[model samples]
Target: MRKGIIGDILHGEAAYIHDLRYQMKMKTGEGVWRPYHLAKRNGNLYPTHGLGPVAQYMNLARTDDQFNTIISYSTPAIGRNKYAKKISQRKTYGINRF
Candidate 1:
């Protein structure tokens, strides 16, 4: 079961935690567009942040445990779009395009 859990994580079986903590207020900063743009190109922006420790603990690629495959899913950016519309209406952040 433990091994399976680790495998699941390595195979992209977790939701991204960045949006949970990164509020719309934080997006108003000047340089905040970098991550948003990068995230646009990369489906999962922080896979290493979430998976690195697990892989290290499991000794993946160093021991018997290894990655067989990897998968990730990108949900619709509904929350972000809604928030962007609100911000755009206010013209507070200059995030018209989102």
Candidate 2:
């Protein structure tokens, strides 16, 4: 009786708790901030959040089923960046800095 794909997936949840709670000081901040602009562990390091569900739905545990390396993608920062540009474009602009 096969259980499922043999890959540990708790990393996504753990990273959420650790980064958002314990490491916000380093993860989130001001000054030319960009998320998808960089990668951790030398690669896109946040794909488990999406992979967990995909695997479950696909049932990658069949006798012939297979799983492979996870892939993460970078999102365009037009929204965030545009907000910053708007703030700076204000005549009375006075944003906080760190």
Candidate 3:
């Protein structure tokens, strides 16, 4: 990630993607959407991972920073549901599974 920042500075507008996974353990019989657990899991106020630090390093916090904020604002739920359906169908038909 540091290398990506350096590349962006030396070059310009380099693109990168990072994947991160986390697991949450629920107490006995706890519902997945329980408010307390949800708050605990989602209460990170700062971005501890990825491009937050890089953007700071590039002085993006300043008023005169050139970059504009852009967002896709899309969730992967639809794609994930489609993929799961396809996999289930393949398994039911005895096709090769990924």
Candidate 4:
């Protein structure tokens, strides 16, 4: 029987989807990695960024199994607003107007 991580994934009947979220942080004076406005305007800030790895593991498009649809969702940018507020108060984020 198949064993190990890769083998388990290949032979498993079901799998779980888990990923680490990128916390928006200011890069010196370059502003935040994921701008709040862009995130709000676009449904998903990095829509396909995390899909490549999972797709490769699942062998999507390489085998009969393929991705048929995708549903995405996002929460309010409360954390971003809070972080911006804190940084702005410190007068360091270099964000005069956000």
Best by TM-score: 1
How would you encode candidate 4's per-residue C-alpha lDDT over 1-98 as one tens digit per residue? Answer: 22255454643233334321223345533245335344446356455566766676667778797879865566665555555666555433222334
The candidate scoring highest on lDDT is 1
lDDT of 3 by residue, 8-93 (tens): 56432423443211111222233223323323333332333344566666666564775565443333334434443454442221
Residue 56 in model 3: shift from native, Å? 1.2
Position 88, candidate 2: lDDT:
53
Q: Which ten-residue region of model 3 has the weakest summed lDDT?
A: 19-28
- What RMSD does each model have against the real structure? 5.3, 9.8, 10.5, 6.5
Relative to the unseen true structure, what is the C-alpha lDDT of residue 72 in candidate 1, on a scale of 0 to 100?
55
On TM-score, the stronger of 1 and 3 is: 1
Tens digit of per-residue lDDT, candidate 2, span 1-98 = 02446654443221221222111123345322323232112334565655566555555655466666555445643444444445454221112210
- Superposed Cα deviation of residue 38, candidate 3 (Å): 13
Model 4: runs farther than 4 Å from truth?
Answer: 1-36, 89-98
- The per-model lDDT (C-alpha) reads 0.55, 0.38, 0.38, 0.50
User: 1-98 in candidate 1: lDDT tens per residue?
Assistant: 25666354444233447543243345556336643563355366566667776677656778787878766557766666666666555332324446
